[model samples]
Target: MSVENVMTLEKKKGFTLIELMIVLAIIAILAVVLIPKSQIFKNNSKNAGVTTNVNTVRGYLETKVTNNGGADSYLNAATLKTAIASNFSLDSSTFVPTGSSSSEQLVNPFDKTKASVAVADKSSGATNNTVDTVETSASDGADGEVVIYVCKDGYVVFGVDKGGDLTQTFKVK
Candidate 1:
């Protein structure tokens, strides 16, 4: 090849600094836009997981009550713990009951840690927001823990705190 042709070919072999900088800027912009969206999606999935767990426990309770011939009975902490231990196939590595008594814990989807199931005090009135109190307890709240509040007439309330801005609760008659 001619000397001039060879020189031009060598100069055009690689991209210019401006071209490389433009590509980097595009990538940065994409990251800025997509990173927050990915985090939102992650949080949403975790929230869904918490919801599923709450429903699973609720179903277990309902089934137990149904099998007992629709009888309204009081389910204390120990009774609930025994029922859960009997019904679910727990993995020792993940399942850890907290209290020396009969406290049971479930894995929290938000932090992947165990949360204890606590019973609310009887004096606490069962209002529309009763579940909120259970979820916001200073200890044993959130982290995938469940709270059970049994009504005098045999109704049961279940609550779960999902750590941030999300608390779920349901009532079963």
Candidate 2:
């Protein structure tokens, strides 16, 4: 080819640095806008999974309590936890549900420890807002002790730790 023709072809065939930079900038903008939104969706899915699991356990506990007659209802956290372990074969590993706190197992639905379980009392002998009793799907006083706290509004609060923090509350079905 002639020198003039070769030079013209070279000028037309290649992309300028500015055009490449513009493409890169567009990609950067898309990443900035999309990355965080995707992460937000992921976090939301995780949280929903946790809530769904907790509610599922709660529903199962209610069913067990109902089958035994309302007189044998869980009515508290400890009873519900025992019901889950006994009726559903819920082990300490899968029951942990959340953090190190005893209540984490009940509330987090992702903890996997053997921390003590407790429930709120609904009996007349209990002090207000204090957990004073233990209930279970197993026979009463079974070594599987769970503290019980009967809520003022009739919901039972169950926790996993000694302090009774992180309780999951439930209404009688």
Candidate 3:
């Protein structure tokens, strides 16, 4: 071959700018598609973590109460709070809102200003937590009826809210 023709063939052997640009564009598109799905997967993981923590708290309470000889019925908010407080051995400092006057333990992660409890009572049932509307302890008036051992918005509830039908859907005690 001629010297000039050989030089031209060598020049064409490497990738052109257009080819490089196309490859970069494909990679960018794939990254865009995958990023959001990865975020969603991360959220699902957080939800599962919350569920596990809340259940751990519940199981502890159930075991304590069952072994204690059916000590007392949760009559009103105060009595229930005291009973739960003693049974679970939860410290009042864990209460959310940043002070002794807060009353409730944890705020919902979705809405950090609002209260959410791991164990609640349904006063006729409403929302997905039909078991019991979150209530303040009538006794202490500085603590929520539920101990809220895990992150807020944790604990999955199941079934209808009835006189005594509130129960955790999963194995959260």
Candidate 4:
């Protein structure tokens, strides 16, 4: 090959400072967008987990209340957790809803507070939605620190619609 042709054919070496800066800028931009989005998705999963946990607990409550004959029965926070530990497939130590201390306080997926929520039929709707209150731990009450309650005919957490199933949606009142 001719010397001039050889020189012309020499491979380009190293990136221009501008090119490197552009690539770095792109990565930075992607990080900015993706970081928040990832967090949002994580929170969404946690929220959906809240709904699923509430529903599962409600079903167990139904069985417990019914086996005792009638929906007049109820379960308090500690007892309810114990029941869940025994009945559900999770290890007892980790059975409580996640994202908080497992002692007794149920974690709120939406609020990220130690206050846990519960569900049950208050109307004994007899094949309908039982009014359940999403009970929270202390830090949300005048007295400070309360337990979750599920009764035969009253509010449990929030006023759940008597609809057959909850769509896993919520807006803080």
TM-score of each: 0.67, 0.51, 0.47, 0.52
lDDT accuracy of residue 148 in candidate 3? 33
In what order do the candidates fall by lDDT, top score first? 1, 2, 4, 3
Candidates 3 and 4, the one with greater TM-score:
4
**Model 3 segments more than 4 A misplaced:** 1-6, 9-14, 71-173
lDDT of 4: 0.45
CA lDDT of each prediction against the hidden true structure: 0.55, 0.45, 0.40, 0.45
**Where does candidate 2 stray beyond 4 Å?**
1-7, 71-79, 86-90, 97-170
> Candidate 3: lDDT over CA atoms?
0.40
Give the per-residue lDDT of model 3 (tens digit) for 8-116. 8888877889999999999999999999899777655544444443454466545654675432321333444454444434443332333343333333233334333
Instruction: State the TM-score for model 2.
Output: 0.51
lDDT of 1 at 112: 43
Please state the error at residue 18 of candidate 3 in Å: 1.8
Q: Candidate 3's error at 14, in angstroms?
A: 4.7
lDDT of 2 by residue, 1-173 (tens): 89999998888977899999999999999999999899677645544544454465556555655776653343454555555554434454333334333432334322334323334345545444322233422221112223333443333433332222333444543
Candidate 1 C-alpha lDDT tens digits along 120-162: 4432355533322333332534555555565443434444544
Error of 4 at 86 (Å): 4.1
